[model samples]
Target chain A: MHMALKFVLLTLLDRERITGYDIVKTFDSAVGYFWSASHQQVYRELSKLTDQGLVNFTSVKQGDKPDKKVYRITRSGKQELQDWLHEPAKESPTKDLLLVKLLNLRADNVDVLLEELDRAIKNAQQRASVYSGIEKTYYSKTQIAALELDDLALFLALRKGITSITSHIDWLHQTSAEIKKRVANNN
Target chain B: MHMALKFVLLTLLDRERITGYDIVKTFDSAVGYFWSASHQQVYRELSKLTDQGLVNFTSVKQGDKPDKKVYRITRSGKQELQDWLHEPAKESPTKDLLLVKLLNLRADNVDVLLEELDRAIKNAQQRASVYSGIEKTYYSKTQIAALELDDLALFLALRKGITSITSHIDWLHQTSAEIKKRVANNN
Candidate 1:
């Protein structure tokens, strides 16, 4: 198993008792901002964690939906999470495809490049909206003071995401405009 | 072969006829900013590209050192790069381990978290210095106006990188200070 997926699954389970479906939903919404894993990957990791005795699950019969296993972190899981928390993490290298395109762009593809920039701007804006919603829902003023250290850490992570997306959108706009200006000057 | 690495290598070849060692050197220095691959991965890809007739290499006899393979992009390689430039790229999902740590932080690990933040700030500063050197060497005022479209694109990519690192460093400082303030308030 990839160490990242293991740590991420443990992180999610450490939050609250949740079904695999819930993990998938969280990955799609909140946790997905900083870490990405497919639904299948989450389910696979959940099974592995269970087998490893790191997480335990209870089967709940839903009225209409299929029977789901609601997973909770074990004592062992808590110990692992605590150990992982104290361990130093290596910074992941950047692997942005848009940056790759910009580095490799040709003069003939300027229009296509602009289209890509537009797409990126829209994507960043959408992410910004999602992040803002997370902030409002999870880090509201009334909730802020009541937050434990762990919650505060998650809030800080969310804030970092918001900042990152905002900066990215600004850079996209600036780059798009600069390219247009350069093209116009050439003409 | 990973498509991203292939395009990156082709992009490098498009700039100049460079030896394999030069590609490795560039990967360690400039290209490492946005993408990453090990030396073996790069060599494997180069061999695959050569086999596909997209890249060709000539043997160079050095006076003292061992012989080297100087690689040049072929017509097919240029076409592939152009095609790749036009294709739409997905926004690569963020996968930051520090953010992961923040999300999963234990209350007892606050001191370690602060240490990690300090480490990150130092690393970002080091990267910022390297980027500044590159900007000075390649994008000086005279070079900026005289840049060909391709060089201009590389310059724009570099500027985006600088902007990203600056934003990241700012976030680190802000989060660090905020955490400290919160700890004091709680006490």
Candidate 2:
């Protein structure tokens, strides 16, 4: 799991040859959904991957722009990604900020926490709507049938995100009610 | 969020005065629910916190054993926790290996992934059940009412975990079915 960055890099390279800057941009949008890394970190990892021979890069010159290095996954990198895909997935540990806040909440702050929980629920709803749009665009039966394996896999990941967010929203409402009841009783 | 280690240390200190070793043990069981840190990292963080005056420990000698430094939260630490509790939580980026694998899946690996998904579903079910037992034991309404703010916070965190795992289990089943359908169609 700690080598998640490597997988992210390999996954990107598997799609198309890319430069460090391109990887950073892609990470901010698509890959950002699943992972976050700094531009510097991406460059650092790219260099390390190149050094390890898991990835190789070639210089590309543009007419008006400075020359750039475009990286591609080596055979070893592809093999590594395949091996990792077969490993059993462990549920990631909890790192939700709202959950952390809930765990350390003071009695006096119950009202504020409830308000924040409501906000979180609304946020989750917005995210779900956004993800559902993507689903309709790319993961519907017709689309899924047409997609190649890589695209289909991404669709599956998007599906998980949508499903997980929807469930979290449901729980937020239920937990909100529960907390409100407790507060009422205490008062 | 990068200061997560600080919060982890404070959360434990707020529970009771505990040694670095105790923190390692607690992380493996209780704190293991939401966060992970190596034992060496825990020791390092404890020393850092002590230096920062956010936490302080007194060295106590044990007969025929080396001295132990038991740490406790300082006033500053408590204040910091309160401040953090009020700060809005950003959605932690997704890092689930299953999702990552799914995003990069190969066509031939569908069968293997389905088997693993089934295993993951079982694991989520087991985790949810375990969390339910803990809820029954320690987070019943009566127990919650009697608990201090810190305990209540922990209860709330536990609630989120249960909700999340249950949701994840539901998603896994749904995803499994979807994958099966795809596999059948492809075959």
Candidate 3:
């Protein structure tokens, strides 16, 4: 497993006590916007974090459903995350499939490029709408007034997602307009 | 090898006739800004493209130096690229390590978060500067005046790269300010 997964789990646990299922749900909800991990990977990493003393799990008895293990960061886990977070993360080139396709454009295939651009714009708009919904549902005005530092952290992440997507949509529109102009000129 | 590498090479070869060495160099330059490919993956994919008849290469023998195999896109390869470019790409969640780390921030570790944000800003600025340089060198006003559709394609990609990075830097600064304000509030 990637060491990044370990830190992702540890950092998540730092926010709140959550069961393995909640961890997966959290990923699907907001964390998915930044990084991805499989359910198996999350469960596997949870056990490893337990053994390493980075996290501890509590068994809560339930009347009907099976007892669940709620997990949270231990002292050592917080220490570990603090140390790791201070380091400068290396940036790698992000793969934008539409941008790659854009480089394949030819003069005669202006419509093909336009078709691709339209699809890309639709995709980005869908994402931005979903993100906007998440922001409203999870970080409402009332919630914002009462936000803890941890809540602020997630809020910031959500904000980042919306802004980035907005930029992509802007670029898509600009590219579309520029291509249409070039076609009009027949240069 | 990933199928993406195949298209990356074909799209590149569509622009010019270049050897295996030149492919690697191009990847490091403009192409490297969007997608990543190792030299070995590129070499492997090049041969696969040759076998598939989507690309052809000419072996030019040099004096004392080893022979060079220069590659070019076949007609079929252009058709392949054009067809693929039409399809709407599935969007995946990009892995941004810093954003994940931000979700782990605590009130007491404001300075730690600040340090991380500082590093992120530096990394982004460095990349944005490099891309700005590429834009100047490869797509100057004089060059833009005479650009073919292929050059325009690359220019659009470069322009997209700059806008995206600029947005990230803006986010980094805003997040830093917001975190500091929260620390001050202590509410």
Which candidate has the highest DockQ of all? 3
Q: Candidate 3 at A150: error in angstroms?
A: 0.8
In model 1, pairs of residues that clash are none
| TM-scores, each model vs. reference | 0.90, 0.88, 0.87
Candidate 3: residue B27 lDDT (0-100)? 73
DockQ values per model: 0.63, 0.57, 0.66
Q: Write the per-residue lDDT of candidate 1 for residues B4-69, one digit (tens) a residue.
A: 889988888988899877888876777777777777988999999999999999999999999999
Best by TM-score: 1
Give per-residue lDDT, candidate 3, residue B149. Answer: 75
What range of 10 consecutive residues in model 1 chain B has the weakest lDDT sum?
Answer: B101-110
Candidate 3: tens digits of C-alpha lDDT, residues B105-147: 7767778778889888998999999989988877777777477
Q: What is the C-alpha RMSD of each candidate to the true structure, in Å?
A: 2.5, 2.7, 3.1
Each candidate's iRMS in angstroms?
Answer: 2.4, 2.4, 2.2
| Higher-ranked by DockQ: 1 or 2 | 1
User: On residues A1-187, what C-alpha lDDT tens digit does candidate 1 reach at each position?
Assistant: 1398888888878888898888878777767778877788888988999999999999999999899999999999989988887777777777777877887666778898899999889888988998899898767888876788777877888888988888889889988998888889888
Candidate 2 chain B least-lDDT 10 residues: B97-106
Task: Candidate 1: list runs displaced more than 4 Å.
Answer: A61-64, A136-143, B141-143
